[model samples]
Target: MSDFLLDPDVVFLNHGSFGACPRSVFEEYQSWQLKLERQPVQFLQRELPELLADARRQLAQYLGARSHEVVFVPNPTFAANTIARCLSLGTGDEVLISDQEYGACRFAFQFAAQQKGFQVVEQSIPLPVESDEAIVEAFWQGVTKKTKLIFISHITSTTALTLPVAQICRRAREAGILTMIDGAHAPGQVDVNLGEIGADFYTATCHKWMCAPKGSGIFYAREDRQDLVEPLVVGWGWGKDKTFHRENEFVEHHEWLGTHDPSAYLTVPAAIAWHKQHFTAGVRQRSCDLARLAVDLASQIDGVHRVHADRFFRQMGLIDITSLQADPVELKKHLYDAYKIEVPVIRWQNRTLIRVSTHAYTSREDIQTFTFALQEAFNQRK
Candidate 1:
């Protein structure tokens, strides 16, 4: 496996939280930063637009969406906030969300709903999901005539479940409800075709799964839905009327949000290239296999259970540790301080879960080390 640009001392298994970029990609990102420093005005004014355009084109092709429909955002949270804030929902209208959504995104929608007086409804997708169809059915049960939008996670952060977003999007379309997918964990971890999924708006973090720089993310809005949403920030992109050019609005409104750093966005193409060169389909599958092995081994321990079936997860898995006496916060701290293992122990509903994430750089030894450390921790607690 290719060596990732992660600290070797850290036994990192938290790819879901913040991705570690490849050394090559990091170097590429630094090169862009250096170029910007050399001639600030020329690089930002003369060169950035074309370079960003090329990056968008490459990313769009990879995502199976039109180049014009994609815009670089700092993160999925920002993109979700933009869509949530601009949505034209009223007091009586409802925005349906799944129970397993990322907390940051849920907060974004809640904040927006508070401002707009729209109701945010949570549709419970229970644990140990049997099949994709069952999940879809459970989510659909929450929809009503008052539903104006469906916001769901492509891959849940806390549960580490890969939701059938494409299926959900199709159903939402049939119901005449707009769909916005929070795909923070889906992009490089799995094959994602935004056009095929047919979501009205989708946001994904390249920083999480694509191994891009920390600020890299993409917001995709369908051609028809673009008109309904407005930019979160009004910058050079907005005209005197506080509106943007029809075709250019999506990119113009969202991409230039006060321009702190475009280096990460420019390096996205490099990240894509690095994944192509090192982490092929076979490599990704191997990583998933290792992650599954970790989950299986962890689940076999007493009082532990797998959060969902294999079909509901891809490169990561959540193992339920609710029966353990150890507090989730204390356990997480012990894992980090004692074993130098970095992973997230999340609390979902009433259950405590240990979310294990894997990537191309993860090895069998890494899994073994984690399992050994976990066993030791549990024994000590017992």
Candidate 2:
């Protein structure tokens, strides 16, 4: 609790939205910024390439990937945009995605499909999830001969459900379909092994679950699939014979992007160190327990029910609160304004749901506070 810089006044249960970085990691980020300011030319021109490479190597090791197969990006949205805009899709081709994906990343694909004359097909995966096998089979029902690519989330945003990406990736690979996994909510919350998952393209946000500074993320392309991707922005790394920042074309082309500030990217190692020290297996299990507690407490209220089984959720859980007469927007605002409880009220599949996230910094008392506030809010609405 003392290690993080989260607001003490608020019962913050919304860690899934944007993670809270520890003071030590934030200090490391600021130190990199200060170094950049102190000697811009020396840092950017002479030292940045090696520095970035070292940082990328550390991150790749953490993600269980080869250094050259991965590169740092500003966020997962940027990585999704790069992939969506560059993939060669045309008429008669279909890009399959689940309906539970994050909105911004889904929009990137939709926009790209519009431009490339391809169809974006979304498979509906309703809640009250049975098992990972059921989810994989339900999603696979949408696949057709025209399906060229499969894009899905490692963990869903609104429902906080962990999909069986590894299984899906395996099946897609066997069927010769390209796979892109949006792991925005993975990394810190769950164990991720890129090689085991076997996705051709994957992107994750270090700032979300990994608790790095904002604007930090990673994009990974398997060795054989790197040639399929081209740089979204043509900078110093694009033209042949031009002095490149990195020897790896996949990294050099996407990593440079004119260098607005690499501080967040460089601080990822510090964040990983902080996570290892503070978020031990026991601590992570406690966070999961708290998240489950939130869902359980809320489900006791009339018209509310937990969405998924305990195995389907990690540090976050979603409860359906559709029976409440209050609008989702007003309920969210009232919870924050009146109770100082920060959580997400989502409307997915025409049903109102509340998603609660518990991290290492979340305490039992905080969960109690949120539960009491939710009970009071519901009673007042009646």
Candidate 3:
């Protein structure tokens, strides 16, 4: 409980958002920042490449991927934007995405589609999901002959539903359609093997479930598909006299995204170490159990409904708040203002949900606190 730096007063239930870092990890982050400040030129020019390379090696090992197949960006949005913008989408080319995807990633694709005279198709995958097979089939229904890529979330943002990305990726390969997976919330919460999933393009945030510092994102492009993505920032990675190039075009092209604090990216190994030490299989199961408890609590409420099945969500669960007479915006404000509970009430795909995320630090008492807070919030509306 005292391992993390999360405020003791506030029952932090929004870990699916930017994750809270541990005291150790935060200190490690600050140390990197101090080192960078001490000798900026020496750190950035001479030592930073090897430092980043070591960090990438450890992170790639954890993610079950080759070190060259992945590179760090600021966030998943940056990776998505770079990939979406770089793709040569012509007129009538379609990128199929589910309705349950994160808004920012969807917008990136939509913006790219608009700029390049292409189409971004959103396939509806309604809640109360039956099975993984059903979800895969439902999403596959939207793929057409003009489909160039399949972009979807490994775990959804608003709904907190974990989609079967591997099944979709496999089917996409069979049909010769490229796959881009937005796996912002999948890394630490779920068992992820990029080699097994095998998407042509994948982006995830270490800051989210991995509990690393903010602004740490990982982008993966296959060796063969590296040509599809060009650098959003045409910096030292391209042209002659590149700082670090070991013949990995993907690493060579997209590694340098202008000079920024590399502290967050460097602290990934610390975060992974923390996760490995604390988050045992039993610990993870208990967290998921708490998430299920949230859905159960919502089910007991008069008007509230559980959004999806138990298997559809991991540490985060979404409970439908549509039946509440109050607006989702006011409901969120009231929940925070009146009760000291911090939870995100989101409206997406025409439904409102009070999404609750329970990380390793979350306790049974915190779940009970939110349970009481939710009931009080709804009762006030009446």
Which candidate number maximizes lDDT?
2
TM-score for all predictions?
0.97, 0.98, 0.98
lDDT of model 2 at position 40: 98
Cα lDDT of model 2 by residue, 1-382, tens digit: 7788988899898999988998899999999999999999999889888988989999999999999999888888988998889988898999999999999999999999989999999998877779899999999999999999999999988889999999999999899999999999999999999999999999999998899999999999999999999888878877775455575788878888885999999999999998899889999999999999998988888888898999999999889887775598988999999989899998877789899999988999998888888889878867
Residue 87, model 3: lDDT of: 84
Tens digits of per-residue lDDT for model 3, 1-382: 6889888888888998898888899999999999999999999989998899999999989988889989999888988898789988879899999988888888998898888988999998867889999999899899999999899999988888888899999999999999999999999999899999989989999998888999999998887888888888888888888866754877878888778999999999999998999888899999999999988976898988997888788999888878775587787777777766788988776778888999888888888888888888778667
lDDT of 1 by residue, 1-382 (tens): 3467677888889999989988889999999999999999888777877888889999999999998899989898988898789878879999999998888999999998889999999999877888899999999999999999999998888888888899999988898999999999999999999989999999999998899999898999998888888988888777755333423767777676765779999999998898898889899989888889989998777877887777778888778888886698999999999889999998778888888999987889888988888888888877
Candidate 3 clash pair list? none
In the order shown, the candidates' Cα RMSDs to the true structure are 1.8, 0.9, 1.1
> Among all windows of ten consecutive residues in candidate 2, which has the lowest summed lDDT?
238-247
The true-versus-predicted C-alpha distance at residue 72 of model 3, in Å, is 0.3
For TM-score, the strongest prediction is 2
lDDT of all predictions = 0.87, 0.91, 0.88
The candidate 1 region of ten consecutive residues with least summed lDDT is 240-249
TM-score of 2: 0.98
For all candidates, what are the clash counts? 0, 0, 0
Q: Which clashing pairs does model 1 show? A: none
